[model samples]
Target: MNDWPPVRVLEAAPRWLRKVKAIILREIGSRYTGDALGYLWAYLVPLAWVLAVYVIFLLLGRRIPIDTDIGSFICSGVVPYVCSRYAVNAILRSRTAYRHILSFPTVSPNLVGGAVFALEMVNSLLIFGFLLLLNYSVFGFFEMHDPVLALWGYFLAVTSGGAFGYLMASLSTIVPALSRATPIFLRPLFYISGVFYTANELPPTLRDLFVWNPLFHGIEILRNGLFIGYESLFAMAWVPITFILVCVATGYIVQRRRLSGAPVEGDASWAI
Candidate 1:
């Protein structure tokens, strides 16, 4: 006769959490495996963008009409835009990138996408820190009127990008054409998202229209945080927050159904 206590049962929520953590680590490792610079590139890429934009403005002999310095204005906008772009692209590619790994029961497409999104969040934070240092050292001015609000705005921006990316990921699986068309769709947003200018610069009607774009609100919130007198009076934080929540909720529903062995609408064989 053999006597043994029953094996401890792991709760489903905790098990999934563990799986997500493992996936995040594995993906980070794979992304930087052969690269010498590795994660340093994350910080460097944003810095390059900021510098490039600053130089362009300087060459054009155009000064930012805002109260804040040029460096603060540029960095505030560039960092958030870069983070949003990278986060969305990374999530859009997650399904295809981890298709094989997603075959495992514990590894779902949502998990892979979530892990990639989480990685982007971490990278964005690091980039923000680096920008702060650069702004302080080179520009000799870096003031945060509301650091907490700034961080909250940054989080919303990144989350909104990831949520939109998840929506795109789900749709691309249904309509293969979307996979090829996403970048083309996002091209217009670069100019329209208040990346190079502030929302307050616009006329009343134009500002009204621009504030609807979640990205504009994000940049405004970020600037408000960085500048002492700069207040984004037109932006209502709830708008982006609601949009992201809706996207995330819808994405979760679709992902859950897909993972439950339901056939995709257009492609039955599409297993993610």
Candidate 2:
């Protein structure tokens, strides 16, 4: 008879999935452990932001063809945009924040970022659900034109954003200057990413300027998916896939070369 397989390594694929699931749970628990509202805050924070943006834009007297009520339209774009941005930031900092954990057995650096992405996705889903409930109850904006397309867009945006975050995290680890100037670097992206408005509404000059902003493309794809009644100008699959590949490739190269561990302008960690 053939020798039986070992219990510890019964099947590599299932074991790997189990490990990833554990990591995701651990991250989520650590993040919301003592909070009274717990994960409810995740839904609240984005909702609050969306409300603020809608009021601000309303006061400013600017409008676009969102094809839905103001709240839902704002939420459709903002939820995905905020989720992607937070995921990127969290993943970018994971390596540094949990460097000690990496010393443990079976803990890969990629897992560090993956856990962050998973947690962010969870929060995003909660926000999306809340939006759906509100849309149905308040505005009757329960138009589900293409559920599959919406899911695809949301997933693609998160994946591409997370990949880019990994790339940025790796680079910042090598170049500490970036770590010190984080907010300064990301602020401009907020205005240019088409998060608050439709890309078509942007002036011709501004539109051309933002055309090269990959985040804008990703957000537009997400908006098109969420705003069911509206049509998108760009191809969803092609833009997201190309952007994801570029970010993933750059991140892989940095990881393989151990570039993230390299020294930078400052920090003793550089000497290590």
Best by lDDT: 1
lDDT of 1 by residue, 1-272 (tens): 12223333443567878878887787678776636688777778888999999999999997785787888888888888889888888898777778888777557677788878988899888888888888899879787889988888788777778888888788776677886787886777677777788887788887877777787788788778778878877766887888898888887776656544776675434355
- lDDT (tens digit, per residue) of candidate 2 on 1-272: 12455654555658677778877777667666646687677677788878888888889996756777777677766777777777787787777767886766566677777767887877777777788788689877665566677777777767767877878776675676765576575678768777777777778888888777666776676666667667767434676688888877887667655644544654333322
RMSD to the native, candidate 1? 4.7
The TM-score measured for candidate 1 stands at 0.87
Error of model 1, residue 47, in angstroms = 1.3
Instruction: Summing lDDT over every window of 10 consecutive residues in candidate 1, give the lowest-scoring window.
Output: 1-10
Model 2 stretches with alpha carbons more than 4 Å out: 1-10, 34-36, 259-272
Colliding pairs, model 2 = none
